[model samples]
Target: MSLRSLFVDFNSYFASVEQHEDPSLRGRPVGVAPVAAETTSLIAASYEAKAFGVGTGTMVREARRRCPGIQIRVARPERYVVWHHRLMEAIDHAIPVGRVGSIDEVACELVGRQRRREVAEEIAQQVKNEVALAAPGGAIRCSIGIAPNDFLAKTASDMKKPDGLTVIELADLPHALHGLELRDLCGIGPSMEARLHEAGITTVAQLTAADKHRLRHAWGGIEGERMWGLLRGAWLPTAPTERGSIGHSHVLGPELRTPVGARAVLKKLLVKAAMRMRREEMLSGAMAVRIRFIGHDQRWERDLAFDPTDDSRELLRLLNGVLDSGNRRHPLPGPANATPLSVSVTLMRLVPRTQSSGSLFAPTQDTRRVDALVDRINNKFGYNKLYFGSMQLALEHDAAPMRIPFNRVPDTDSENEAGHDPLWLQSLNRFKAIAEGEHRRRERGGKGN
Candidate 1:
């Protein structure tokens, strides 16, 4: 009996979710952009759009030119996350879902006394049915790939798209993988492929047959063997158990040039990074804030140590101080010049809040009070509705993160008042019919007694 794994990958997950929610987008060439604009590129592209050479990271303009009928919608990370959670829950109901790789893809490990093939098909059918029911009136589909290992399962999943199922058995490895490019392997990224080519290893077969010593010389000891094993269908690398860091970075558009404008952008980035860190249930002991100038010649970066905080306000304050000091040291020589590059806020040294160090400066209670007030004002009226004076103009962009999916998250005040649990409700509703049957049985028993 051989071990078998099944990988179920949602097709063009974010774009598919959008299309599923909006039937009008079905069968059309649609692209999701980070922001709603002609300038923004495609963050996700549907299969219909991909047929026209439109893919993730493609500029909207180019996508349109390639497929003149392409429709572009801004990326809604919040809405997408909601659907992602729902889909994962659906899969969990069907089979043991392995760690989620990204917002869209998940691997499920098949177990039990039943045949692996039967289990894979049954689980795939269950997942398909669950998604269809949960996402009403929307078209959401997944492709299932069955293989002896995770690497092959992933490759099999990619073999078919827009509702596909591919199975790669151990015996079929040679033929199935023959003529395939080296880059098709999971770990062989562009950089690795380039290095392999430099070593005269142009194909997977060449890589598999290369001298272990020579390959080790090229790639480090562990990584070299890891690559070789993956090519031969061996799953040695275990899936990561926990998340490492939460960070966000973006290049400042033309409008964000002045010191004030830069600060506005920095605040938005900080709030975004902080919010994600909180959602992940993680806190940072140290943080890094960076800024780059127009020509890429001048750059400034600062790392600050704190008593482990995830509060947006505190993070923004530190970011402002860093920016202030950088500007003072590297004064733009004149007001006419502007920095036209990127800003990033990275939260590092992640630790569970329980393990965080006690703040020497202030009590946690006081900090929570301030965060509550800020969260309240932002949730009630709108994000940045009452911001630290630096972000007046930054709030004007309708595509800003806070404004885009404001309706998705629970309102702070309303949640405090009602105490209703949406997640719990969803869980109960999932098995309502089963519970109803039990209730009927109890009623009959009572009547008979």
Candidate 2:
């Protein structure tokens, strides 16, 4: 009910960072993308570029047509990660972060009620300054919003951008929400907005005033009530916490086909996912694999429990079985008849290894040593210095497939010089201690209190 949350959004982030350090690009419309491939779309655009209607997912060719003389550059992934790490440290200096949405957005739950707005604004400005200094040749700014909950905070942040500080006080609720479009809110994208318009709810105000029963009927139940409450500046009841899960789903491109090709793609994805889970120091109690055959209009899914582990090879073996189960039970239409459109994997029922049992035969020692060796190689040189065999040709086949990025490793020289609270790494030795303490506490009968 009270405004005790802060949402931080980087301002025209990638392009701003580019322009801030280089005054030459200050007034130019700029776009940052992963690859220069003709098929790749713009990932981030400057405020000047956005004014000309350029946005993420806008095709590079169309963006050029929209704004002639626009500057486009491939993003420096390593530098961006360093900037993100610095910003994260700056934010945590002000408030404990509750959730990190992406490289450019973070949410914080204010511990104390008094001075929430003042603290949030100060933190936002500090972050802007710190990121600009930490990221060389990078100029970045952020807009922040302080409100009662995540939805409102995010909405308030987006209401205005590029150095915006919009606050949504409880008293400003229903009236402030009047003319806002459905898509202006976070979850409702273009498709949902179209559906809402067809249902005769065209504005946020209208949605709030509509009948709950009718809204539920049209919007398919819980989502209707959620939208209504959000528009009224009401907070959803907080749920109990549980172990976090990691999952990813990707639809195959035109080039990927055949059962052999599909299996290879699945193995590659699973390996990457397993490595991420291992880095988090967590294990999965169950796994799920799903396949969608759009051309045949068919879907197949399988889930199974397993001894907790983060072994990539083992996960690949399990993935094979999960897919085989689906195929044996209800075979997908032939590859000729159906395109294997989508493959998804879920590492569900996650729990800390200290709390869950792992496979007795698991190669923990060998994998741990390999992970350490990989870390050493990456820190000394850069990411992908050593990689799984499945991903060796990633760069050759897919120009921009997300691989192990260089900035994933903590900065060693800076950490050594500054002893953990480096101006660059922006982390402290105490954080690791605290994390270990929490892990030990969880091992006991009680979770961290």
Return the top candidate by TM-score: 1
Candidate 2, RMSD to the unseen true structure: 11.9
lDDT of 1 by residue, 1-449 (tens): 23367788888877888898788999898988665555445667898999999887676777899999988987655566567778888888887778555556677776674236666777777878887788866467888787777778888888877678887776776578766788787767767888888888897677767766768766867678665666566766474446565554554444655566666767776775575566556777788876655433345677888777877777777776666663475432222364434555678888887787646753368777776677667556755565655556665653134321111232234332110122222222222222223334444567679
Question: Relative to the true structure, how large is the alpha-carbon lDDT of every model?
Answer: 0.64, 0.63
Pairs with backbone N, CA or C atoms under 3 Å apart (clashes), candidate 2: 16-139, 17-139
Q: Candidate 1, TM-score vs. the true structure?
A: 0.74
Write one digit per residue (lDDT tens) for candidate 2, span 33-63.
Answer: 6556433466678988998998766656778
Prediction RMSDs, each to the true structure:
14.7, 11.9
- Using lDDT, give the best candidate's number: 1
Which parts of model 1 have CA positions greater than 4 angstroms off? 113-115, 122-126, 129-138, 211-221, 235-244, 251-259, 275-283, 291-314, 327-341, 352-368, 372-386, 398-449
